[model samples]
Target: MMLHTALNWRYATKRMNGRRVPDATLERILDAAHLAPSSYGLQPYSIVVVDTPELRERCQPAMYHQPQVVEGSHLLVFATWESIGNAEVDQLMALIAEERGVEPASLESYRHTIAETVARLSTPEARHQWAARQAYLAMGMVLTAAAMERVDATPMEGFDPAALDEVLGLPERGLRSAVVVTLGYRDLETDWLAGLKKVRWPRDRVIVRAE
Candidate 1:
């Protein structure tokens, strides 16, 4: 059943009909992103859901005028935290301590370790890069979950990150756009890519044995 479920899913979406995806389905996709694993449990990113037609129209230019930006039912903009500062680390450590019922004082050693690690990457650009990697993990999880829910999705990296950040006002929140995924039902009639075969390296060629 698991194999069948996965095999039935493919990234063949190019154009999406204007039909809207149900809110519940979208919620499930977002929930999957929330549950995705991240380094140090920092969760250094947030998912921005763009469902309104007006907003999508505005975002189209940022996405290289891609039709899917406005045609899809929803556009999920993955934004990464701008910087990893002491405040952020402290908050995460505090939450971990509280959630695990460990003494806050016991986590002082961990706090110092994490603080020093973040301190080493002092520039905003470096921190953003780290956060972007975490966002990609969430993006992958969202795509897989969409497939499981029988929804079509397109993982796009062709957008102008700076423009998207400006349009979405992410920079104001100390976040930067890392990636975008369009979600909806695929338009089989107009999408040529839908009919093309998916190409990938064979498992034998891609996977290497440790021995």
Candidate 2:
């Protein structure tokens, strides 16, 4: 019920007040993102939180000088792996083994299933696209959590990805920027979209039942 309320209350806030979300609330939102499901349980992405004014200023241009980029309390960059391969699968297998208290050898079959998916992707571009989808899942979680916390969040894909990646030096780390989110309280007086009704397709039209 709370989630439904929050979803209805939230919008892609265009302007944000200079109010900072509490550190505790920020943590919970991030935790929810981390718990987001990923293909093969391998989260092939990382979140870059830019809270410093200097950093936000540098990132603003990359994001086409979007007001929320620098106006919000923090900016979240969801960068997915540039590519996926056996190395990544091995690392995930190792983590699974350690966390589950099982030997790596025991998970060979499961690892092969993941590896097969990676192999089918073949090209780096294909793999990157898949990784980007996983990043979106995490971003969705962040949006939901922020809404529930009464924090305003704006998810934007209007930025130049190459510019943003360079601004954050993501390539060297084998990462590519997929999406971004800005978090803060909305500026009700200045945000024109504020106080406006939320619009959506009627459920019957949006959700089609399979015959």
Candidate with best TM-score: 2
Residues 1-211 of candidate 1 have per-residue lDDT tens digits of 8745754566758898988989999999899999999877889888888999999999999999988888898999988887687999999988988899998899998888888888888888888888889899888789888888888999999999999889989988988888899998889999989888778799788998988
Task: Please write out the lDDT profile of model 2 over residues 14-116, one tens digit for every residue.
Answer: 9998898889999999999999999999899999898988999999889999898877999989998876889999999989999999999999999999999
**Model 2 spans > 4 angstroms off:** none
TM-score of 1: 0.94
Instruction: Check candidate 1 and list the clashing pairs.
Output: none
lDDT of each: 0.88, 0.92
How much is 60 displaced in model 2, in angstroms? 0.9
Model 2 clash pairs? none
Off by over 4 Å in 1: none
How high is the lDDT of residue 120 in model 2?
94
How many pairs in model 2 have backbone atoms within 3 A of each other, for residues 3 or more apart or on separate chains, i.e. clashes?
0
Where is the poorest 10-residue window by lDDT in model 1?
3-12
Candidate of highest lDDT: 2
